[model samples]
Target chain A: MTVYSNCHVITFNYRQSGIMERIYLDNNATTIVDPAVRDTMEPFYCHMYGNPNSLHLFGIEVRPYLHQAMEQLYSGIGASDADDIIINSCATEGNNTVILGFYFNLLKDTRKKHIITTQLEHPCVRESCRFLERHGVKVTYLAPDRDGLITAKMVKDAITDQTALVSVMWANNETGIILPIEEISKVCKEQGVYLHSDAVQAIGKVKVDLQKVRVDFLTFSAHKFHGPKGVGGLYIRDGLNLPPLLHGGEQMGGHRAGTVNVAGTVAMGKAIELANASLDFENREVRRLRDKLEDALLKNADVLVVGKRELRTPNTLYVSIRGVEGESMIWDLNQNGIAASTGSACASESLEASPILTAIGADRELAHTGVRFSLSRFTTEKEIDITIEVANKAIERLRQLSTSY
Target chain B: MAKSDLIGGELWEQYSQRVADRMNNPRNFGELTESDAQKLGGRLVIADEGAESCGDTVRLFWIVDEKTNIIKKATFKSFGCGTAIAATDMMAEMCIGRTVDEAAKITNLEVEHALRDQEDVAAVPPQKMHCSVMAYEVIKRATSIYRNVDISTLAETDIVCECARVSLQTIEDAIRINDLKTVQEITDYTKAGAFCKSCIQPGGHEKRDIYIVDILARVRAEIERERNPHRTLSAEFAKLSVIKQFKAIESVLDEHIRPVLARDGGGIELEDIQPGENGIINVHIRYQGSCKGCAGNVAGTLSFVEQTLQKNLSENIRGVVV
Candidate 1:
């Protein structure tokens, strides 16, 4: 059949559809800035550009936006009060602040120089705990089981009377496995040790109620949802005192200093609002697309899905194809205008295998070949179909080309 | 629409068009089979190189004519990032039609420059520069195999950061280009100090002759000397008599090395100094007490004393146990 009627048809089709069509499946890395959030933040760049720290009208006008953002975050995350939210940079910085803040406060008490965390935490928390270890603070990194789930009993067994704080991630970035935060929190509470949960990957993907979880602190970034980057927040329990992480002018009640990022805060508020509104659709439609993509890819004998037996984020599907290299598969997918990521950072010049995958007892070969496809509410059934087809073809080509196979 | 803003604005923009082109269509991918290798007189050389920090590995194959020493074909199979693939592909392509000796001269810079679509632009980002170095190493390895020499003997350049694959020359270049004044900036630009960080200073997971800190200080001093050429104190010190150098070395050892060695009931004595070939000062030493039979005396304490003397006294000092 004559697929191309003329040169104009070819040019138009290529311009309008072929190269223009992009299938993004790496939402765990970062999400696209939402149009609604961008619209909400647009006016702040010039028209509403004012320092919230200033006392003049320009600053006074922007203060309300920051307050609104705080309120939105507190309500969205199910915090007890808006005053407990400390807005800062990305989730990494938020995690660092809370971790270091806890450590700094406990420094005076030599008896409490120990911290407990999981091995599958995002690199930020893991690195923070390592830094503490380097500075003479004892740390225990609890590795997850085969399903990428860290048990509450593991935390309880690891915690000693000397433990000062316990930090665990609500959801893992690579495997999408959800840890038992409530159970871990209860154990921490019985032991009288502070508990913090890095909810960066869980805030929008799953429901997080501070009332139910009873975590002493929670950390998340806005960009994990549809908000802009450079904005994250930390939730501290009311009546708990944390030393200021950032020292300067009095800001956030002397907890963190530096002028507030007004537009980013506003966009974060709008994004969280939109995320909460669409939570049902995300758990249903997005989950459906993710499941369909995983099921279709599993038709191949080589394909193995990660965290299948554990609770995971609705939009994330981590899979490893035997004998096919994840880096090569991602490059091939990119050639076909698709976006994805490997679970392991090894292929990208950092020689370490995916600690998360390895922690879950995946062999080196399987860990190296793991690919993570994190979906969003914006993902469509058509995109899922295209992703399945493209990914299968790419995996087949890579497996054939792989010399080790 | 989403092409430009995949990861973010500037981070994704750091990659050039050549990187994308080569990643999608690698020039000389895949290894030659046994029969295919027989076409070039059965002198096919295969070598593998791996980056420790990121488990990326590259395997290179070369078909060399033994009589002519000319490489007829070059191919590679890389399990790594796009930069590694592109760099290895370009490296293999650059090797073909050239003599094995000539191919051995290919540096990571040359591989990167060849992959550049335009002049004076980096083919990859700063962090990905190690990929090019990995390609350069595999070429040396293949050449070593062809020449029937040990790969370590074939390596002429000193590599400081094994994890980042950063050579001494690359580290100096980064310092000079970016005017990197601190170890952090050097790590940011060249990633040398980012991994095991043994290259950061004396105490780390690994050890190197020239740490990133030393390279930074040397480059900065060279810049200062270049700005003011009349400075002659260091040069005069270098030209001092061997006896005078020995005196300085004795003082350094007595002050820094002996006290630490004394803690372990060990001491080091300077026996003689002879000016060896190529301006290398061969200083002979005899270990006393428990140090004479200690394993660390030869392995660890020897380097510690030598490095201490070199840092405090002269760069030409080379300590040898008698």
Candidate 2:
């Protein structure tokens, strides 16, 4: 493995003969697995390969590591020992489980058969609500305000007696605008409704103290926070008694049934530990780099940043250049060894205007032009400088060719 | 930095070198000013078209030499993706020395082909194919402006698939040129019925004036007739008995007409068939379901049924609503 002192600058093996310097700014999509996390996971793969459920001495040796990892996970989010965090696949699975589990466990035959989610949610939550809608569940998709904010009052006004649960994302994946989850959680508690927050984008980037904010359920994926992909955690508030989404073995206390991904769980523990330690770096240096890039982009007359910087996750900068389409900008950036995104990578394949941008009342033309540049703790000032220069040149060339002017 | 050292990986290789070059530094970018046209002793024609799906717009500017009806210069401006820039730049270059009429004949396929570095490799991906189509559309728009005619008269063909901008003439030409057989083949070659599929056949999500299934059948029949040279449609229909003719007309109505009307909560039923004066065969029909007593049954629906029967069965057959 090649190591660079500056973690952001890496030599990527291009399809052609030579190597190219790769600068990653799409960390909100996924992050590179931290070296420490990788080192922690190495032993679990071959050496400590016993199933956590086995009764042999091999399983007995692995119990303490699993217990320590569990403690690390609970402490990362400030969840008390009373609550349960079921390790599962990515946050997409966790989101589906929570949203669907509510319907099957509590809301299916009840008079309260309604779900409330925002229009700006990740597709997992939005699609899960859509799946329930086919089964006679009435879903009210609340639209965000012009500033891309979903207020506590919006949730308060939208809740009906027939509302079974309110599922809101802690931070929007595209815009990175942090929602009022605390106030929304209080409202859900007051109304006696179950609340689930898909905190996949918020866990490592922002402060997520469950002791401070009382939410019934929260879900996060490890990949978004510099851990290996595939493994995620779903926090169930104590005594909730929700039925399992997968129904075979008696793993995760019969809440989730597959054999635990020991390596992935261990890596996730180290990733979260590193994330907590680097929270200050994320808020200061990463935010500074993101702001520097945003300032450079804002020098252009037609660039529109999605949300105010203060309200968004410090590492994120979502901007729309008036004339340049998102994919075109991404293409130009890719050619220059810079990595960025046009909203969620999952939905970018459809080439449709971003639903999050549209939900925030951006015009159709502006919505198609949104490019998100997300920073990570490893991103350096030199990478930011190079990105600013390359992005400026791309925007200028694309604008010169644009008919919008 | 070396050009080959770009970090796009496979996606960079997907685009032709010419496309990559033009996309990065388009030669025919920006519009020609009125003074620029005057210096060339020509008139300026500007036309723009927008893709509603992706919000990409392309505008073409041409300086036409009025005396010879030739294009003195052509340039373009695109508010779209990179492929749109490359496609429009290549289109503009192709139009520079040609006459306005000659430039109007330029197809999206030619523009797409002109950008390819290799013989058979596609210049752009399938999703970006519409960018080249957009370039072709702006040319028609510019031609219409230069000729002072309506844009619709320029193509002289119905747009069969609006999503992909595949015209009936384009589809028919593709079928003839490429020897395309099935609708799937047409979609693969020309991208008609590839998206939304409203124009593939009747009873789709949206109503279409003309369908690809009908075009395929008509063009295939034309090809068949050209090959055989002896089996004439009129002679074949003339040999059928009146009952056979009625059944043929009924089947044509069932296949072509009923499904479209059914979607609108209406239906049609054949009443009778009679030999009118000369070679004319008059087929009587009645409206059913929501179509009964509807004013459209006499006007639009009557002509539609007559046209369907005439096209499928025999040109001598006419429809009279009872």
Candidate 3:
């Protein structure tokens, strides 16, 4: 249901396919699969499909592909070891499992079940904390740097012996500010408390080295790297006894259960392989296009790109188009066959102030009015130009609409 | 839209919610007329706590319940959001279950003390502790009415802005909830507006009804009419003063006296006519849609009008019964 009057909540069905435009800028939400990755997973979807947990040859045949996907995901992020990767349906599930699983262990042990997390963490992490708080767990919300960055010292101060784990996003989903995960992971490491990082936005866009950062857990969405949606991998440091988030049949070696989605695994693996292989090309080209978009918006609209400029992902721009409610501008662009996101889409219904924006000390109006434009490997210069043109119009029009209100 | 829609619309929603809440569960609305309340103050307590101390500066509203028993719901209607609303809503809620005697001694300090640790509960913020002051006052006013005592300045203080509810909590909550930056936005959301008119009984504002003394006026007129007999002129005295009074008033000669007078083809004038010289001011006036210069107007109206004026004004300046 479209819980509010303002939304397109319907799932993509064949009904909309004919009318749907090809250039969708809401890649940060999800993206089209890479052609190379699609070809790689074609066999699994039709012929080689099998439950990897099965003992039969057909099942065994898919296991290698799943393992290969995990390795690519691990290697792509420069993981020191492959066994740390735990495959899951999506980054949200991975984030929940890490946070909840850690809490369960703490609750079970009768240890101090406190968690320290940044206000900038996603709803997957933030809501999980809220849920856990209702369950009698204490949480200390770490503040961000003025530009919405969190330094290692904030993590150091926030953590206590009672702190079961610390979660900080590797890069902000909306702004793409690369947080000081390395320094924060160091703090958590020294404190002997576990650290979980939501690396879904960070992994493919930037360099992440479990080899360097040493977070206890990390989550990545395969779709973020042109993989199939609903297939992600979570990295758990070896020998941390985490409680499983879900249970049923003996699958994922009993860590996670129920039959595996074989096609998802295959496509995820293929997408990761291609993404890893084309890393520099995708990275440089998308960044070039993003710069073009960002520069044009800045030069033309005089907008402030939220978060620090130097330490951000090249494929995304969180522009504060002043004098416009971000959601209205997003809708305006949407009507023009362009796609973008307000800082608070998907969360529009709660109508709650964004904790992230508030944490960053964003001006309340500006926080609510922030818009993000994320680019992917398929994003072209022409696409950037179109977005700028559409954005300028949307911003101007939305500004007018805002005045009437 | 209908008047009901205006009262219930977005314009009035916030105030109505606040008023309803105070009416139902004023934060410090219930009475505390405990035998133990003797320690609170030297009285049978039946209003807000902290009410015994004068100048507590609380803001509260009183509404006569369907019971016709006064319901005092208190809040710092002056205190400004959720805390203000919460205290008002909560007090109103709790007050419903209590008695007039219990509502007094409802103190802000007690409500504040109740809310101090309930950051998790739906209590107003700490900064808005004073709103309980108003909630406290509502209880006292309701108590006074219950006892039939007159309340003046003690009850309705100058409401800062009827629409905004800008008391400490409303302002603070507005500043905090939507993170509103300016006073204007706070006004918009909290509705510290005056646009939505509240037509309270004309009797209530000055604390007296104009209609109540109307009967006494009629009675005094009757006494004067009895006191003075044979008061005014033989119709030959077409007094200019009486004619001027009628002219100054709507031409009853037109509405009530005009037609008959027009038929007479002679008219009255208003020069130096003494009212008592015209007994009860009983000029028998008659009328048509158009005006009348009635010849009998001097006899028609002089006495009854004089008596009516003398009776209503009560001899502000006594005059002849003419």
Candidate 4:
């Protein structure tokens, strides 16, 4: 006889899989793990499951794979040296490491207690600054213009003698607005300040050459480009002595300390190799499909494509339909078996409007009405067409029912 | 082959087929015609409700038989997600054949129940559960309109936790009568804040009119005030540093002012603080969201902010619109 304590449980329908017709357009939230990446990771799970630090042949054999993954990732992102790459968890951990690293490193220095960042950063970076702000650090959040572009002049104007670091993203996760990192780097270099970019959304979609940009630090996650989850990389320029966030036995040259995620690195290596090979396709075919979807939706519905005037990632299309809300639009699209997202997935649950949308000077109603349809190499023309149709119908219905409309 | 089968199709298992069916062909859709309304004794009422978070709205139309005081027909137009449509459609269907008074008694839970094919399985996803609430509110407005009464005064009980159907009076009585201290105890007693947890704090999955923590704190403060009526609320708030003072004011605003502003798609942000005349602290704030450029900012809302701050924070503190 089975005895239970309480009967309170939330259960789902548990329908059979491989039976529904659904379109997944929310790629920025997380991409599906590539089959090639999965195949590359499968062998390590059983046969070659060895700790990279061990003295045996199993360890030595896996060590080469880890290095190869790092080499592939660094080369793909245009990092000059292999030692600069420090593998960690997702971009959240990488961002926290850089922020806390700088915050803790600058604790002794009385004069340099200031940090400059934009209002368009991911919550990981923005919340980290807020955490520092609560602990007596002065943070100046530079707001963006209407098009969601943060000028290098904005960064230059905000930087002062007391400023220790300037952290910004290469591309926004929500609006896909690309920042002028090279120009921002030039200003930071002139001001003698360290600059960090959360390049998670930019890694697979755009070309980021650190040699050309001259930024001190950059970060990217593996899963954004069809790799497995739980693995990311950070690049620190030479001679930057920032403290480590994690403390343990030597790992990644003591920059990030944890037992090696060998399988993750192997999958990431394969994923990045594929992503680099398909960069041209992403810039062309993926972009064309994204444009087609946006154009179709704009023609049929009254919606504003966010950051249309600025440089944006090829795979992202952020739109704000008049008289309808983002959550409802996404939900209606989901009913038609389409997957889209509103703002960042972490903050999606909360009813608060997207802070990024607000930061870009969107009116309150428009900020609450935006939906993001992020694509990947896996997204097809057929899916885009269906999404446009479903989205238009959903919007039309919602507008008819809406009090605002 | 179905189009989505090309992709793995594993995640679609979350929602039941009944939800898909209801979403595709919603029941009780569209509106009652003028002739149809005339046939029902010209007792027609139309009510529109909106969700601020997503800007989704629903317009409910009800045709009541004036002589019998019974609803002859009900229909709706929804500008929202599938859940809102299905919930509103089901609510309209539930309204038919019942008197306006009886139809007004139908709750959002009953609307949700009508949409679900199974008891355990939800008709809509948990996050979309609030969509059904729009349907429930529109019904109240429709009923009140048909009866020529105020909408706010219709809901006899003060509902606090919508998901659990717990009322404000029930929660207040639970705390005061049972001598409760913790939010968990209140949940165990009345099941308020048990389901969605939005009624418990500021940053929950859903927004609520009143929170359990606030209710508990107010009740506790009232009890304290009864014990010693001389002690002032937020007396030391003025003595804190500018940022700390901002933080305290921000909490008060988040707890009180922001919710009221956010309801109308408006918001407020603290811009600065400077010394005013004769030891008064002047807090400069900029209106955001719908509040920006609103004509009411000068005469109407500014007074609400000033009065609320003066009554709560301190007499010397003043709110200055920037």
Candidate 5:
């Protein structure tokens, strides 16, 4: 009877999944696991469940697949075979490891006790810098310009002889503004300081070639590109040694120590391969849909889009619809079976305005009204059309209700 | 996908059915024009209030019958979150068909309760409770405009919780009527200390001489003394020497009042104390620091000082600002 009930539930969900027309535009938060990635990861769960550290035949069979996944990860980020790619749990963990590793390994012994990062960093990087500050490290948080660009000159001006590292994000998660990381990396190289870029938003949507961009450390997550959650990669350049964040078994050459997540690593490998293959489609098709949605939203005079279309990633649209609160707009969108976000999902519950918008010099009122709609390659034109219609209706109704009008 | 699928499963459950329904379709939305008011044989009263904490605002429209003093029609427009819209919708609905005096008596708790799916269940989450308080405030503004009086004249007692409009009299009445003991019970009944929570105790975002903690202690002590009728502390203040009386009053001001004023860069200094007719003790105070030239020193702050002194040291003490 239990098996029968389980089958009934599965059949019910399958039928509902095919018929429901839910529109998802919050891809920057996370993405659905692709069917191809899921298929590639299925065998490691039960059939080939062997600990990669064992010397038995069962473990020997898993070695080639693990090596292949590692190779895929190395090639995906354009890292050479000599460079080390440490697979860990998500970009947040990777970011913490790199920032804290600089303090624990290099800066602790040297006279250089300062680090420079931008105000536009993810909370993980920002809070990690703050944590280091409590431990007697001087940190400079450079603010972005009105265009939401953190220039290379800002990094050069903030750099000093005591500067040990410079960290910046490749693309902002809120405004979709890509920072000038190439020039910043060049400046860091000239200043004899290590450079790290949180390329979580740039890896799948844009072309990120580590060969051309000489960043010392780069981090990315597979889930941002349609892989499973709880798995990501951190790239360390050749001839650089940072102490391990997690200490236990000798895994990933002791750079990061843990039993390998075989299924998640395989899924990430497959997802990155697919993401690389779909780069052209992402630029052409996803960009077109995002532009269409932006054009539709711009028809209203009260709407203000955050960044220029030519400057941002192809999939993100962050806008502030005046006289409508972000949470209220998201509530209306969710009622219509459409998903969106405001600033960050983690900070949405607080009544405080978006810190990102405030950092970009937006007024307090405009900062309270930011709504983000991030697209994926799977987002259809019909979904965009429905979203446009629903969003317009919500704006009109909410504006009529607003006394400011 | 279901609504739970769009929002997370846990957050989706926070919205009650009635709140969601009213947010989607607010029945009492939009304003009444002057011609519409004239058509209903009443005068239009428009009142708007804004919440500085979240930049949410609500504007209320009422057409009061001149002779009968009844609200002929009521509507509102809210520039806020979904919970604000639902709260203002219910607040405006409760005003219609009731006299202006009766409508003015409506509280945020009543508006919040009217939006609930069940009797005991809350309509909105705790963080959104301030939206209903905004709704209740706009009604007071509209009432004051219709009656041609100041909004402050409508409240008979001091405000204990500025965020939720829970006054000292309202909280005391709620505690006495409902037999409330805990601070959570006071919040659940009167919505005091629900938002910001600076009024709950000292060392919060703001300071208050008469915190909910102090009020609970005073009320419980009064209840205990009432049961034991022979016990009294009223004559203790009159029996003290002049120097001891001055020290006693200074100590009470130091412990209870100075911290609240000092938090906002203001303070009060005791100028003099003298005996007045009818057994009254006149305590003269001069504003120091940021309190000088401030308008609240004449009204709210002065009364709060007197009330704190009366509750703590003696009931015969009166505060005089010099």
Candidate 6:
């Protein structure tokens, strides 16, 4: 299958047919951009080609649209100032700049190289911590609450003068458990620690009020919120010293230098706006689908649903079908037209347990068998019914194959 | 799977359909439970030793309804991967309400050839086969977490799903209770019949799979193991028979896999490689500081060491360290 990326969102034209043909359910891995978001990106590719960083009328005229996009995003997430939003490649780079840069800057004043994070932070964060640890820097990985929630208390207890930063996620990707960011930010404030939250999964799913929560930094990708894959934004508090991850040019306030992903940034802004606009209504709708799918799998198939019961991103549902291989089940479902994920899209090819799954203490089998089906507002009832029918057949078949005993 | 001798067309068609009848009609899916298992449980599958005694007399599926903390729905189908016909036939007949979480811990290893235990009532498959059995066990543990909802309600709603098992609750539960960290454990729970079973070794499987250059690499492992037959195969070694002959290579390797590497400007530090159902071994070699990023590290060190050991050891080891 060929997947085309426009304005960063990957939209696919699937042409398989069958009652057995598959339907994709793993949107948590990525998403198809809203049609309207795509339309907004069209004009920029063909018409608005002037560089915002260039001189003369052409550059000056294009600059406001870019700033408008920035402003639209800030307003959407409840950030008070647009200046603090630094657009960059996805959250990975943002996470790297904030986390690594914070450490580099901290090293200037104190050799106290320490980072405290949740065990479930995204790989960008987890790996950075691992890399730093290799350099003799200390990092304390805070564990999440049972059911995968990261508690402020966990963060509070892990801090010391040695800690350069506290990094956590606003919502978990695998289980969709929303963390108590406001409370955790408050704790960080009280303790005088800088806090960085990888809000990638939580961006469009939950409301993030940078001003209200008062975190030192917030990192997220646009595609997760319906933007593009490579486009994302980072929220750094005003007057914060953020050294550039790339050093060249005056782009992104010198914090991140490179030719701006013009169409991508604009599209991401639109995606964020769309998400904020439809969040509440879509929440109830997709969550209804989530609950329905979860209930059906539980009732008919030997399946289990994962994620926080009440406080989680509305679309994600993680379940395991007992006595079946996830890979076989995935292949079987795909043969019939169901597209879903065993774990994060970034790491789907791997059979390893998602770090988030491990953080909440899921065992190896469950972690391996985990199938994440995330619903979007456009998902239909017929698709769900088909999923149930297909799931019932495929799960039973695969389970039969695994019955070695 | 037997060659059909019933040449009368109509009669054969009728017989085939008759057999398919047993597998028809939404057989052996599952549900959660309500009562807290006296000793911790959710849903289950309990298969009694058929004419054969496979250790799995029972496979339990479990999940808690977050709302009630009660097991939601619990059900089981007798597991028999091989006796596809007889196993399912017996499973449908035998399993119903056993709730020991361990009962569901059966793996594909135990199911080898389905009716392996049609006679022996208490025979456990090899300890190594447990990972296969444990794959289902992991799924059973994962399935137990679905007590949070009711199925009838979902069909009427709009949740579009795509996973064959579209549910991870049971697997998540297993992880929570078992404290499993690696993909091996999760894969075992799901019984995904590892495409490559090298990950779940007793030691570390940080890399996915290693690639040995040629038959020489295979020979080198034999030579290395033949050299040190006493070097313990990981606890998860699935087949001990072929693994048994590695002493010649083991001694050679302890005497060699590294000496050859050290001979170059580089050095080799051996990391544990797990042996799976197939005789494939997974290994890692660490190069000393200056030689770290050298391009031929894999070929020069890994290949040379592997080739020497396998070639010198004769039939001591199977596939490359990968």
Each model's chain A TM-score: 0.93, 0.94, 0.90, 0.93, 0.94, 0.91
DockQ, candidate no. 2: 0.21
> Can you write out model 5's per-residue Cα lDDT over A1-405, one digit (the tens) per residue?
111211221122212324367889999999999899999999998888898888998788888889889878888889998998899998998999999999998778888999999888898999999999998899999999988999999999999999999999999998888888899999999999999999999978898899999999999999999999999999999999888899999998998999999989988988998998999999999999999999999998888998878889999999989888777788778777788988522124434465677789765666667899999989999999989998999899889988876
CAPRI-style grade of the A/B interface in model 2: incorrect
| lDDT scores in order | 0.79, 0.84, 0.58, 0.79, 0.84, 0.59
TM-score versus the correct structure, for each prediction: 0.70, 0.78, 0.54, 0.78, 0.77, 0.58
Tens-digit lDDT track of model 5 for B29-112:
998999999899999999989866556789999999999999989999888887788889999999999999999999987887
Question: What TM-score does the A-chain of candidate 4 achieve?
Answer: 0.93
Worst 10 residues of 5 chain A by lDDT: A1-10
- How far residue A378's Cα lies from its native spot in candidate 3, in Å, is 0.6
Report the CA-based lDDT of candidate 3 relative to the real structure.
0.58
- Kindly indicate the candidate among 3 and 5 with the higher TM-score: 5
For candidate 2, list the clashing residue pairs, or say none: none
Runs of candidate 1 with Cα error greater than 4 angstroms are: A1-17, A38-72, A81-83, A130-136, A246-270, A322-327, A343-358, B1-16, B34-54, B62-69, B104-107, B137-322
Error of 3 at B312 (Å): 47
- DockQ-superior candidate, 2 or 4: 2
The docking category that best describes candidate 1 is incorrect
Model 2 accuracy (lDDT, Cα):
0.84
> Native-contact recovery for every candidate?
0.17, 0.44, 0.00, 0.33, 0.41, 0.05
What residue pairs clash in candidate 5, if any at all? none
Query: Going through the candidates in order, what is the number of backbone clashes in each?
Result: 5, 0, 87, 5, 0, 107
Q: Tens digit of lDDT per residue, candidate 2, span A230-313?
A: 999999999886778899999999989999999999889989999999999899999999999999999998898989889999
**Model 4: colliding residue pairs:** A325-B54, A398-B79, A401-B77, A401-B78, A401-B79
| Candidate 4: regions farther than 4 A off | A1-22, A344-347, A361-363, A392-405, B1-20, B39-41, B51-54, B116-129, B155-159, B162-165, B195-211, B221-322
Computed on C-alpha atoms, the DockQ of candidate 4 is: 0.15
Q: Candidate 6's residue-wise lDDT over A1-405, tens digit each?
A: 011111111112123333633465777778888788888778777788778888978677668778779988889777877348889988999999887897678844686677898888888998988887887788898877667777888888888888778898898877788889999889989988898999888877778877678888888888887777789888888778888888999988787889888888888888998998888866888888888888888895456777656887888887866665454455445546678766521123222446676667654446546677888877788889888887888776756544431
What TM-score does structure 5 among the candidates reach? 0.77
The 10-residue segment of model 4 chain A with minimum total lDDT is: A1-10
Per-residue lDDT over A1-405 for candidate 4, one digit per residue giving the tens place of the 0 to 100 score: 111111111121111222255677888989999898999999898999989989999888898888888788878878777338788888999899889888778844577999999999999999999998898899999999988889999999998889989999999998888999989999999999999999999888888888788888888899999998999888888878667888997988888889989899889888988998888999999999999998888895567888863388999988888777665677667656778887522124344568888787566666667889999999989888878777888888767665566
Residues A106-194, model 3: lDDT tens digits = 75467778999888888889999999999989998888877788899988988877888888899988788889888888888899888
- Which lDDT tens digits does candidate 3 get at residues B96-128? 545555655465445444543223322322223
Q: Sorted on DockQ, highest at the top, how do the candidates line up? A: 2, 5, 4, 1, 6, 3
